[model samples]
Target: MERKQTAELTNLVMVYDDNGNVLVEEKVGSNYRGLIFPGGHVEPGEAFVDSAIREIQEETGLNIKNVKLCGVKNWVEFDGSRYIVFLYKTNKFSGELTSSDEGRVFWMPLEKLRKAENKLWHMDQMLELSCGNTYSELYFNRNDSAIKPILK
Candidate 1:
């Protein structure tokens, strides 16, 4: 028999422009290539909000002194390795936007990003759903290996 595991994930307060453009960091890692958000695994005894702020600072060099929970995303795999993403938003911040060891940073129009040929990971759907004012959580499963969502 095999045991199931649930991974605790944390995403940052992905600041967007007034027009709803999102900034994606170019992940710097052996496996994490191309553009990605500034995030990482949640540390033990760390609050989700604190983790998000820390990650954003580490990746973007921005001080998000204020933020709020926008939504949540949950994923359950056949193996039962669950993943949860905490959606946060921030309209105010300080510090200069500098690059970290993670990746080069740039802004991407959220709508344009949605229409990109190279699809983003699962978060794209969650982001799309969260963009609405009437959403709080989104649940779904992965379709094959692609980023497509099989809503639950």
Candidate 2:
């Protein structure tokens, strides 16, 4: 059997404050639009945590540190290649918040985000993973598109 290789790698980070607010991006791009965490694709040969820190800085103007790996989201593409997203969370960050071309960056209460209607597709599940409620998310694209969460 041929080995299934990962075709893409990405990262998502949930930056939170002590007052129960989490950093969010109101994405303006063509893909993954709506309210989401600050994150992006991992550059070639970059370390996973390094990629997360870099992406957060690029997207939200925050220099994050002490990032903790909370979970992951993965799926098989149509061509049988795999795509993966490493989910990370941290409260340690510095710098003034600013928005990039990707979206507007702001802090929102966790409960408010939970009830928000403008979240990206399957963002709740991703939130779950980032909040340490789950450890893995598997997207199945059979006849019906379904996301299954694997608890930690």
lDDT for model 2, please: 0.86
Alpha-carbon TM-score of each model against the true structure: 0.74, 0.91
lDDT of 2 by residue, 1-152 (tens): 96757579998899999999999999876555689888999899999999999999999889999999887787777777777888899999999899998889999999999999999857888887777554556465533567777755
Q: Tell me the tens digit of each residue's lDDT in model 1 across 58-138.
A: 878888867788777776776767778787877676788888766787778887766765443555665665466656776
- Give the lDDT of residue 55 in candidate 1: 85
In the predicted model 1, the residue pairs found to clash are: 28-102
lDDT of each structure?
0.69, 0.86
As for candidate 2, its clashing pairs are none
How many collisions per candidate? 1, 0
